[model samples]
Target: MAKVIEVDPEGLRSWIGSAKRTLTIESEAMARLIQALDGPLGRAFGEAIRLIKQGSGRVIMTGMGKSGHIARKIAATLASTGTPSFFVHPAEASHGDLGMIGRDDIIIMISNSGETAELRAVLDYAKRFQVKMIGLTSRADSTLSHHADVALCLPDCREACPIGMAPTTSTMLQLAIGDALALALLEDRGFNAAQFKTFHPGGLLGAALTHVKDFMHKASQLPLVAPTTPMAEALVTMTQKSFGCLGVVDGESGELIGIFTDGDLRRHMSRDLIDLTVSDVMTRTPRTIVSDTLASEALEILNSTKITSLFVVDDKNRPVGLVHVHDLLRHGVQ
Candidate 1:
C-alpha cells in the first residue's frame, strides 16, 4: 500500500513563502541588470549587434550544461528573427562537428563561470579558424572571456537558490540578454511582419496572417445584382449564391454601389418589398476590402460591425470578389 502521510498546513505555508522569496530575489536581480544596461554593458551590446549585422555569415552559438539550454533558445530566436543562427554542442565539436564552423561565422559562447571544460575544444577551433567570438559570461577574467573578441559580461548578481549553487537568476539574465540581442538585430535590419510571417507559416499564426485574396470568393462565386434590378431578382441571386447577401453594382460602370442583405429583407418586410428595385432597398456605401487586406482584418470588421459579409473591390471600386465571415472562419482566419 502507498504511504498516507498527514498533510501539514504550516509546512505548506513555509513552502509558499520560500517560493515567493525566490521569485522576489530573481525579480530584483533582473531589475539590477536593467539598470546596468546604461553603462559599459550597453556599449558592449551595441558593438555585438554591429559585428553580427555586418558579418556575412550565421551566428554559431555553443555552450555546456545549463548554459547550453539557453544557447539553444537564443539561437532559435536569432534564426526566427532573420539573423540566421544555429546552436552547436561543444561536446560534439570536439569529436568532428568543428568542421561546421566557418571562418566567416561569428561564434557566441555562453557560460556562467566562463570556464566550462566542454567548451575548450570549440573555443580553440574558433581561434584557429580566426572566427570572431562573442562571450556571454559573468566572469570577465575567465578563459572564455579572455579568448573572445567581444565579452558581454553580466552584472554581479547572486543566484536565487538559498544554497547559491544552482543556476536560477543567472539563467534568467542570460535568456534576457539573448532576447535583447535578437530584438536589437531585428530592429536594425528593419524586419517587418510580412517577413516574420514567412518564417512562421505552419501554425495558428500563419493562418491568422493569411491574405484576404487567398480565401475570398472570386467574381464567379460572388452574388451580384445591378442597382436597378428588382428586389425579387436580387433575392434569387442571393439564394443561388447562398451567401445571405447580394452586392449591388452600377450597370454602366460595373462599379459596386450598394449591398442587400437578409437584415434588409426583414427591415422592409412590411413594405411592398417585391415591387421595390435594388436601388430603393439596398444599403449604399457598404463596407469593403481590397485584395491585399489581411484576412484577420476582415474578421475584425465582421466582429466589430456585427455584419456577415464585405465586398472585395478593385482600384476603380468595381466588385471583384466577396468575403463572408463564414469564409474567413472556414479558413481559420480568427
Candidate 2:
C-alpha cells in the first residue's frame, strides 16, 4: 500500500505560472526571429542556399554542446530532403575526421557565441583546405564569423532561462533557421513527394505513397466475367475471388463495360437474379482507377463513392487489376 501525499495548491499554481512564462518568453523570441528573417538575415540565408545548391558536394555540419545536437538534426533534415549532408563533431574533426571534409564540400558550423574552442580546429582545417564555411553565430565579430565565407549572424536575443544562461530561446531560433534552409533547398530542387517517399519508406509515409498497382489484385486474381455471363456464374466468380464484386467486360473487345457488386445484388433482390445476365444486373460506367494511381488516392475514391472496391484499368479502359479497401487497409495504408 502507498501513502498518498497531500497536494500543495499554492506550489502547483507557482509551477504552472513558471511554465506559462517560459512559453511566453520562447514564443516572443521566435516572433523576433521571424522578423529578423525579413532583413539582412534573409540575404545571408539566400547566399547559403545558392552556395549549397551550386556545389556538387555534401553539407558538413559541425557544432559544440547544445548547438551540436541541433546541427545533427539539421544535417538529417537536409539529407532527407534533397541536399546531401552529414554531421561531424568539431573535436572529432581535429582527430582524423577532418579527412571527411572534401574541397568541394561546404561546412555549416554552429556556435551561439561564435567562439567554441573545439570548433577552431575545424575552421583552421576548412581555411587550409579551401572549403567554403558558413558560420551560424550570434556575434558577428567573433572568431568563427571572421573566418567564415558567409556569416549568418543570429538576432540579438537573450535565453529563455530564468538565469539567462541556458540555451532555450537560442536553440529554438537555431532550429528554425535550419528548418528554413532545408525547406528552401527542398523547394529549389523541386523535391516531389515521390522522391521523398524513396527516402522515407517503411512507415506511415511509405504506406501513404504506395502506388495502387503495388498491392492491387492482378489480372489472374481479378473476378472478371463476360457481359453476357449469367448473374449466377458471375456471383460464383465474385465469391471465389472474395472481392465482393465482379468486373463485366465485353468478350469481343476485352473492354470493361460494367461492374456487378454485392450492392447490385441487394437492389435486384425482387428480380430473378440467378436467371439474369450480368449485363442486365450490372451498373454501367462504374468508378475505376489506373494502375499507377496511389493507394491513398484509391482510398479517397472508395470513401467518396461509398464503395469498398475499385477496378484498376489501363489507358484503353481494360480491366487489368482490382483493388479493395481491405487491400489498402491491410497494406497499412489509410
Candidate 3:
C-alpha cells in the first residue's frame, strides 16, 4: 500500500469540499430517480411484487462486484423482515452454486451496466430452472434487463466520486429500491415487532425492547420466603436463589409483604443475623413491577435507580416471579 502524504489543513478542506459537492450531486440524482419513477418503473415494481406474492420458494438475489454487496444486503433485509431471500454470488453460479436455486424461486439480479460476464451464468440458470427474473440495472437495454420478467430500470445518474468511477450513486439507488421492496413485502406479510424480535434476538436493543415476562423466572423457579422465617434461614434462601434478594411473603396468604435484599442484609449486620427474623430485617413493600411490563420500562427503572433486580408481582401484590439483572444481561439487555 502507498503511504498518504501529510498536507496543509486548507488543502484537506478543499478535498472535503469537493466530496460535499459530490454528495449534493448524488442527492440531486436520487431526487431525479424519484422523479423518473414513471409508468414503466411502476409497472415493473408491480410485476415484481406480483411474482413474489405468487411464488412459494425464496427470492434468490445475485449480482456482480459492488452490486453483489448491495444484493446481499437486500437479501439479508428481506430474510430478516419475513420475506424468504438469500444471495447467490453470480461468479459462484458458474462454479456449481447455481444448483442451489430452485424453479419456484424468483431470481432478482443486479448490475450497474447489466452486462457482467459472470452474472450471465446466473441469468442462464434462471432460464434453465424456469425461475422468474427481476433485473435491477441502470441500463434498461442491457442484456440482463432485456430477458427479465420485470426490469427495475435505475435512473442514469452521475457517480458521487470525483472521477465518476466509484459505484456510489448507483449503489445507493439499488439499496433504496431494495428497501422499498422489503417494506412492501413486510406490509404485505403483516410483519410486526414481535416477529422482528424472532429474527433479531441477539442484541441489547432486542432485549431492551422485549417484554419483561419473557425473561422473568416463574413457578418453581421463583424463590419466596415467609416473613416469619428466621434471618439465618432467609440468608441461605436469598443466597441459594442467587437473586441477591428474597421475596418476603405472607405465611398464610402467600402475598408479597416485604423484600430482603443484600442491602437489607448489610443494614442488619450490627444485629445478630442468626437471631433476627426476616420480619425484623426485611423492608416492607420493596420496588416491584407487574408481569405485563415492557423490558424497556424495567431497564429505565434499573438504570435510573441503579438497582440490579426487581420483584415480579400480580395485581394483588402476590409474588409470581423474580427478575434479575443477570437474566437481562443473559438476554442481551444493555
Candidate 4:
C-alpha cells in the first residue's frame, strides 16, 4: 500500500499559493484576450460567425493533443446551442476521418503553436477542397494563419504552469473563444431555451428546463371540485386523485376560485365542517402556475409557499392540470 504522507503546514501554504498564482496568470491572460476583440481579432471572429450562420453544412472542429480535448468540448457546446458541429481528431483525419469534412462545412482548427504536424493533412484537405478554415492560434506568422480564411490569433500570454511549456493559459483562452463563438451564433439565430431543452432532454438540466405541462396531470387526473361541492365530497375527490389538494372551480364559468388542502381541512375541522360548501372552507385566490412554467420555477413556488401541489390554470383561470411536488422531484427538478 502507498504510504499516507501528510503535508506540512508550510507545504500546504505553498500549494495554495501555487494554485492562486495559476488562477491569476490565467485571469490576466483572459483579460488580454478580451482587449483584442476591439481590433483585427474581433473582425475575424465576426467573419467566422457569419460564415457558420450562412453555411448549410456542419461546423467541424479539429486539433492535436490538449487542443483536441478543447476542440471536442467546443464542438459539443456548439452542437447543443443550435449550431450543427462535431469534432474530428487531426491524427484520425489523416487516416480517413477527413471524409467527415464536407465542402460547405467550416473548420475551426485549434493549435497554440500553429504548427502541429498532425494538422497538416487536414490543412491540405481544406485547401484542396476550397473549404473555409478558421484558425485559432497565437502565431500570426504561422502557416495556419496564412492559409485560414479567418485567423483568430490569440494574444501572446504566459502559461500558468511553472514550466511555461504546458497548455494552461492557451487552453483556457481556446475554451473561452469556443464558448464566445457558440453564444454569438446562438444570439444571431435567436435560439431560445425551448431549443436548448430539445437538445438536452435527459439530465437534470433537461428536467429543469422541462415545461410544467409536460409532467402535469391533465384532464381527468386533476383533483378538482366545484365551489358548491360539500366538504365531505371534496375530501373524497382529493383522496381519489391522490394529489393532497383540491382546486375549487366555478360551475358556471369553470374558473378556479379557491383551493382546499389538509391545512384548510384542519382549520375548518368542526362538526359543521361536513355541512359547509367547499367555497366556505377553501382558501380563495390560491397560488397557481401556468402550463408554460418551467419545472424548476414550479418547484420554487411549491417550496417557498410550503405547499405540495398547485393547479395549472389557463388564461380563463380554469384548472387545466395539476402538478405535485412529488412530480417535480420524480423528474429530477431539484
Score each candidate by Cα lDDT. 0.90, 0.91, 0.86, 0.93
lDDT of 1 at 265: 88
Q: State the lDDT at 243 in candidate 3.
A: 79
**Candidate 3 lowest-lDDT run of ten:** 200-209
Tens digits of lDDT, candidate 1, 1-334: 9999987999999999999999999899899889888987888888899889878999999889899999999999999989999999999998999988888999999999999999999988888888999999999899988999889999979999999999999999999999999999999889976788789887677877888888788968989888888877888888999989999888899899999899998988955888989999889998999988887888999999999998999999999988889888887777
Task: Rank candidates, lDDT, best first.
Answer: 4, 2, 1, 3
Clashing pairs in 3: none
List candidate 2 segments past 4 Å from native: 1-16
Model 3 per-residue lDDT tens digits across residues 1-334: 9999989999999989998998898899889777777767777888889999999999999988899999999999999999999999888788989988999999999999989888889887788767899999999899988989899998899988878899999999999989989999899989977788788776676786688888799987777888778877888877788878888889787788988888877777974788988888888878899886778788778888877888889888888887887777777776
Clashing pairs in 1: none
For candidate 3, the TM-score is 0.72
TM-score of candidate 1 against the unseen true structure: 0.91
Tens digit of lDDT per residue, candidate 2, span 145-208?
A: 8999888988878887999998988888899899999999999879987888888888877998
In model 2, where is the ten-residue run with the lowest total lDDT?
267-276
Report the Cα lDDT for candidate 1.
0.90
Two-way TM-score contest, 1 vs 3, winner: 1
TM-score ranking from best to worst?
4, 1, 2, 3
